[model samples]
Target: MKARKKISRRKHEVSTSNLIRHEVIGLRVTVVHSLNDKFIGISGTLIDESRNMFKLKCKDNVIRVIPKEVCIFKFELPDGDSVKVDGRMLNGRAEERIKMKRRKVVWPLIVEKQLKKARFQPEICEVLMFDP
Candidate 1:
């Protein structure tokens, strides 16, 4: 007998705090930074997403494929706030990432990236943030 994968019907709000668990295909996205200089400033409607790449339809009607790992993205929320996310946090397949119940590591990685620029030790930030 083949086991069926149960899908989640509960819709989680798409906020900066829980954006990783929502479907982001129709949202607007911009490549805020990338390893390749040529890919910077590419703003478009996100049409498709994969584990390691994003397919965007730009204003010129061109579909550009952007690598996720090396790029930082600024995503526009429905409420008009833009959230900058490190692509590494979205490293897994969509279904797997969304369905994850315990994301103990995601926050630390993102916070560490931000705190690194602010000259804070990542270990200290992690311990404080996850402290009971």
Candidate 2:
């Protein structure tokens, strides 16, 4: 006579992403900051791109930064509509995890073409006026 035993195992499944696998290449991006009632902005043209990373070429500066560091990024599409993405820069293990998490949805080939002919220029720089 033999006894029956049950085995426990977890099923691993991959997920399909809805966010576009495309990267912002050669596009212009601006980072703005408003801290302690002071506003500051930096402008640069994009050079390198990963899923969540970008390197920019400024007029007098070169910055290799992460998307999370930006307060806002304005990208002009070939279609003529400016796509503005707003977010905050995050550091430490959280940032590393976010980058790692995006690996599955990121495709290098998808971003190469879009950034080939991109050239960004700064068109706006102004401090917000307070009307009190």
Candidate 3:
């Protein structure tokens, strides 16, 4: 009888880039801002087709743009009616929200509150790469 060889299991580590670029489908983006012209309280849905720039469907208009290059961005929501979002164009659907401010509160509770409120959509908005 031939002796059987012991099989070893090797663990492969997942890279950070792979983790960050995880795939997401059917995700939508919500943007609140003011346009240079007569557009105030400009709200729109962002479309991710590229990294440099994305398209926004305003109330009754469609505009393609590179958000990072824009100087000023403003929002008028209830909690913090005024927010300056550092906009960036990205590809695919985002699976997490990049919080601008890090709080000491529990993440789970905060996440629950976020889910309860529709102020921010879950699993949307991604980091746009400038040189990708």
Candidate 4:
């Protein structure tokens, strides 16, 4: 009898924080928040980007230039996680973002707070009932 060998698939890791440093052209993005009323709800594919602006190809095939300082962007990571980033945080050419100094933001604490306020409210209430 011949022994069968199992094939293992290699996992590809994607860094959520590095999205702004890489080529974002052709990626689908939504304007989650915008200081400009016209751009507040725009959703489109990013066709081009510069240090201060992004050219988005809308459904009507019209390209719109959005100022980076005035908007927040939402996009999906290759690993299926969705992230929202302030446009100001991503200011700079794609290449420059790699060399830029990133701010130290604690995410776990924020996520924990949100989790405690959601879905597990009953358990949280029980724990609170027995508080010191």
Candidate 5:
């Protein structure tokens, strides 16, 4: 009998790089900008999501549905890091988004970040060079 190697699973963490593939329900969200003036500056907990809209629990227990394409969302992570995302990039169902190929839109930014980190901290370069 052969001993099987156990696969280690990394817990999914949301970042600007993986915006479309992560679960976003229950995160604190804010509408930093919107095509409609009414939706600007609305902050709330995300209760639900659809292909084209988001349902949020706003102040005083009010629920509002805002179109995804018309607004820019700022999502606060559990670690207190905030990332702003454009709606156009996230235009698909959760399942579809996960299976879809990742766009290279953020690749340059990620390379820039790794380069900056490598410049400031030489030790990190060894780890980054081996990363896919």
Candidate 6:
């Protein structure tokens, strides 16, 4: 029988959970969309960022400021994972983004489970059993 080639995995796994929360100061990114005609298709290193805008050092050493609200960005992670993120989702500072609350919907099933656990007391169970 022929020997099979063993596939080796990397020793360290890259975590993508912190991608949105970590500082993106030096990451190379492309502007997938922009409201301003000048920055619509710019690709450059993120030299600086603020709560409202990002400054990209484009080719020819030209610095362009683009509003965070009017653009979509695409960047690659260290592990070669390409991510496309909306500008609105990245509106806040990197440090503040970690504290931002994500919008979640409370499912009926989860609410039902919580209600069942809350009503598991003996006294509540007796009342529930005798209730007309």
Q: Which rank order by lDDT, best down to worst?
A: 1, 5, 4, 6, 2, 3
Cα-based lDDT at residue 9, candidate 4: 36
Per-model TM against the reference: 0.69, 0.38, 0.29, 0.63, 0.68, 0.61
Evaluated with lDDT, which candidate comes out highest?
1
Candidate 2 similarity to native, TM-score = 0.38
TM-score result, candidate 1: 0.69
1-132 per-residue lDDT for model 1 (tens digits): 899998764456577767776778888998876656799899999999888899999999999999977667888988898787767666678898777764454545765576556564333222111111
Candidate 1 error regions (>4 Å): 1-11, 102-132
Local accuracy of candidate 2 as per-residue lDDT tens digits, 11-108: 12111121122334566666653221121355678786554555678788767564533244555544455544433222123335333433222224
Which TM-score value belongs to model 5? 0.68
User: Residue 1, candidate 2: how far off, in angstroms?
Assistant: 72
- Kindly report which residue stretches of model 4 are placed more than 4 angstroms away from their true locations once superposed: 1-14, 103-132
What residue pairs are clashing in model 1? Answer: none
Q: Which ten-residue region of model 1 has the weakest summed lDDT? A: 123-132
Better of 2 and 6 by lDDT: 6
- What local distance difference test score does each model get? 0.73, 0.42, 0.35, 0.66, 0.70, 0.64
Evaluated at residue 34, the lDDT of candidate 2 is 21
With a 3 Å backbone cut-off (N, CA, C), the pairs that clash in candidate 3 are none
Expressed as tens digits, the lDDT of each residue in 17-58 for candidate 6 is 545656677877788755455766898888998888989998
Candidate 4, residues 49-76, lDDT tens digits: the string is 8999999999999999998765678876
Report the C-alpha lDDT of model 3 over 59-91, residue by residue, as the tens digit: 576664534322123333332333344343222
Clashes of each: 0, 2, 0, 0, 0, 0
Model 6 residue 31 CA deviation in Å: 0.5
Question: Clashing residue pairs, candidate 4?
Answer: none
